[model samples]
Target: MMRKIENALAVALIAIVAVLPLFLKFMQGVCRVQVPGADIAVLHFVFLFASVAGLVTWREDRHLSLASLSSVFGEKIRRPIESVKTGGASCILSALFINAFCQLVNPAQFDARFWGMSVRFFFASLPLCYFGIIAMISCKKGNLIASLIGMVFGLFISMGPFTGILYYLFGMENVPSLYAINDAWLSFSKIALLPIIVIFSSLAFFGMPLFLVLGGIAYVLFSAGGGYVDVIPLETYRILTDRNIAAIPLFTIAGYILSQSSAGSRYVAVFKSLIGPFRGGTVIAAVIVSTFFSTFTGVSGITILALGPLLAVVLTGSGYSKDRAESLVTASGAIGLLFPPSAAIIMYATVNYFSIDVFDLFKGAIIPGCIMALSMMATGVVLDKRGERPKFSGKEARDAVLHCIPELLMPAFISVLYFKGVFDLFEAAAFAVIYAFCLSVFVRRDFTLKKSARVVASSVPVSGGVLFILGAASGISYFMLDANVPAILSGFITQYVKNPYVFLILMNLVLLVVGCLMDMFSAILIVSPLLLPLAESFGVSAVRAAVIFLMNLSIGFLTPPVGMDLFISSYTFDKPLSRVVKGILPFLIVQFAVLMLVTYVPFFTEAFL
Candidate 1:
């Protein structure tokens, strides 16, 4: 019952937030609730979210347990409560000590009277911190009163002190609902930024969403800049408005159709029929099929899940060792990442500031992607010396091609639709969904309407989750851009690194570690923004930089200790994680070599661009 409620509330929250932009426009244009210079949209989000929190808080039958809620949040909200306690206390002390040191450095550096101001301000805000911690912890365990408190806190903080009252009381004083930015708040907020970053970063380490940290950073920076808190909501509105943005969900639905259908089998058959007669033929077929199939799913694990057993049989049966076969195929699983219409590239491009033609970006990645794919297969060909080459029959080849035509032509069809100017990306995506629907229902008949419906429904959370993160993270982008974070970051890095080669080398090493730690989606959203300016300073084009960055993270799948595909591969093959790590090491080394080459030789990507 609680699970049902949480799902319902989460779905409602996403559905409502998805359409909030239109609602905001209506309030401003038709209802006229917006003040001339103030943002009523932010207030609306505050209220709407509070309302959702209320719904999540409600117990229809007096059933209560926050465990369901915690599971619903997974790791995303788990650490915020505890971290806020320890981190908040540390923040207060650090500010006190730092302020004292600064006071000694030069009494005239700042207002000498304001030496211990940050520490004093922290004490004042300690109650709010306690309120937040209790609210989060209580929400985690499903406390009705705590959820209500959270709702109240949301309303109060969003409205601050000014906008909640004074609407009809004294309405005529130059945008009277306007909550003026307090300067003392600004100075103290700026002082608070360091501790805020450290605390949030700590939460992030515990698996909290980076967006929360980013949002906190945005709030403080916006406060310091005298900007409205509404910018976060407003940027979210802007992200949703982009035409390319709608393509994400459409393609996601389309991908699920193929992944859930017989497309994987058909793809494997086609490759086998065509290439099963050569030396190292099975290895080639496995690489090609896995690469092509994973593009639709945008998940490396799906390759292992759907085709791991078949590929394993083919490779081991072809005289390859079990560990070698498993390792090689697992490494090849992520080769789809660089292919066109891989959903993630769109996410990267959507949030990016540069102008990237999706097709053009697709064109740029072809060579780099192929290099990684070929390199994985090449390593296999060198290691495995197989003697059996099956004689190919023309009838079987024809049958296989005929069976695979729809799946095989998908990328080319979508590319033509997108690149040839025949349709907008959204239309292309819609057509892809429609095409997949036709294949799944009428031609392939892999699932009935009910099953297909479930497939589409399952994809909603993925789409919704990604969109939520994008929206929340946009606030940080706004704040960082406003705060000159990119400039400051580049300035600081160049001050120490000096050589562009050294910077590039460090970027490769650091990103490999990052990839091993976080999923690609989170890493790209959180890390890419920071890396972009630094890469540009080193004179890398956005396309090349993106390719390099993605490729490294792609290889990060083969890394140990929570690499996304490593766990999946372990489960798929019924191997323990330690064995999985050992099996994957050689292929990982080769991928790192490819990564280094891609990093240094911009020509691989540049040639296609």
Candidate 2:
């Protein structure tokens, strides 16, 4: 089946991506031999890895999208809407596929080959992968007519590229009629672009994949504005090939490997042994472990779901109330976003590259990140005020620390290698992957080959999904830039919200709402461009603004109603949503206080800088 093939390809690609970096590092570091075009090869593999993984994610129905409306509606009513969304997605992807193919055959496009693979192969693979997606959609939904209808619309959207292919195969003079039809379609698309975007915006709530929703809007905006829709794919290619962007997948895999191994338990043991004698020591361990896990994974939901139960037991056994423990665990999930090597900060800098420096943002985040983490721990301690606690054993502490030293040394390894200029961001990420692999597989020997495969199978989809959204959202950001939306927004903000302090407060409120609605990755991609300029207009430094943006979204994970952590914690603990919400209330208040301090004071985030 196509599904199985996609999954297999995803796993293989991820394995290669994981190993390729380590090999390259060895060639550079150990052998003192640099591989020519090594960076290019890594970026290409990352691209292929992301593409294949994204398709697998789609096949698995795991692409991130808002589906609250689907939950609200019954299956009978929701089924039709889902079918229509699928068809719409088919249309957008089909157009993109055609566009990619046209680019492949174009005389002007890049034709260089690397590692015996034509660059055109990358372009060529797009159509096949996209067509496969289309086929899989029909196969999964059993809706052939919908796909056919969608393809026709796709042709219309891709009229420019479709006609180019015709001209390249046959002279434009001979295809005068085709050119005329293309012009007519372009005119109609121009008139219809606004309405189409509106419909896609509405469909976002109806469970449309975020990539399709974003890609659709970008494609039409480009097409109607006398720009080539094919450029959207080109832009996607450009982002995926960026020097530092590959680090996202590399670091993500590293985090996944560690999470899948026995790292969490070892960390808990170490934290407990070191702090277990103090009052509220277990609560402190729970917060520390949660923060540590989330710092690597960059996904709070994963932190809560994977380690929540274990931490719950640890906390409950230490005399903490179940409600208080659950609340602390959920709130601690995302407090690590401001820490070093955080994918969120990397993404934030990448998106706002013109203004923000990755190193500066990383440095800026440390103090604020610690404040948030410590605040959560302090709140946990306060909530669980029982005085009796276990006595510390130096021998036990030494054993626990010895066991987790490699795990603890990970942060230090990354910091020394990267900050000291021994490795680039991409190389550092690759090193983290290699380090985690060795620690998990060889050092601990707890991660078996089969488990490694399973981790690859599990983590690739997440990396793919996040990368897919990042790539697609880049198109929207491109359109916004081309439209000068950021400048316009800056002018509006300058006129309306004059006070810098007032703007910071307002920005936090807005981001909290956006966080409640959108995933952090897409939010960073689509929102940062519009926000960065406004922050600058208000005299806020880029590093400080970046920290504020990320911290707000971090706390957004714990915000009420639809905060991601609330749902994950509820499910993980088997508690009602209301109970989870009630439990997290105090931690939320604490995080909000920290957020406000970071937002207003600025020194916390700017201390290192």
lDDT of 1: 0.63
Estimate, for each residue in 1-609, the C-alpha lDDT of model 2 and write its tens digit. 866676677777766766787788889899999888777787787788777877778777778776457777888997787678777988998888888777877878857778877777765665676777888887764677777888888887687888788767665646676677677867877999889889988888887888888888888888778756767878888888887778887887888788778998898899999997887678889888888778777778878877888888888888888888777888888977788678898888888888989999989999998998888878776776777777889999999999888899998989899999988888888888878888888889987876776776778767878888888888888888888999998998888877898898899999999888788988898898999889988889999888898988888877888887787788899988899988888878888998888888878877878
What's the lDDT for all of these models?
0.63, 0.82
Q: Report the C-alpha lDDT of model 1 over 315-338, residue by residue, as the tens digit.
A: 787778898888877988889889
Candidate 1 ranges beyond 4 A from true positions: 1-189, 209-217, 224-227, 301-322, 353-356, 571-574
Candidate number with greatest TM-score: 2
What value of lDDT does candidate 2 attain over all alpha carbons?
0.82
Candidate 2 deviant stretches above 4 angstroms: 1-8, 170-185, 188-192
Query: Against the true structure, what is each candidate's TM-score?
Result: 0.72, 0.95
| Model 2 TM | 0.95
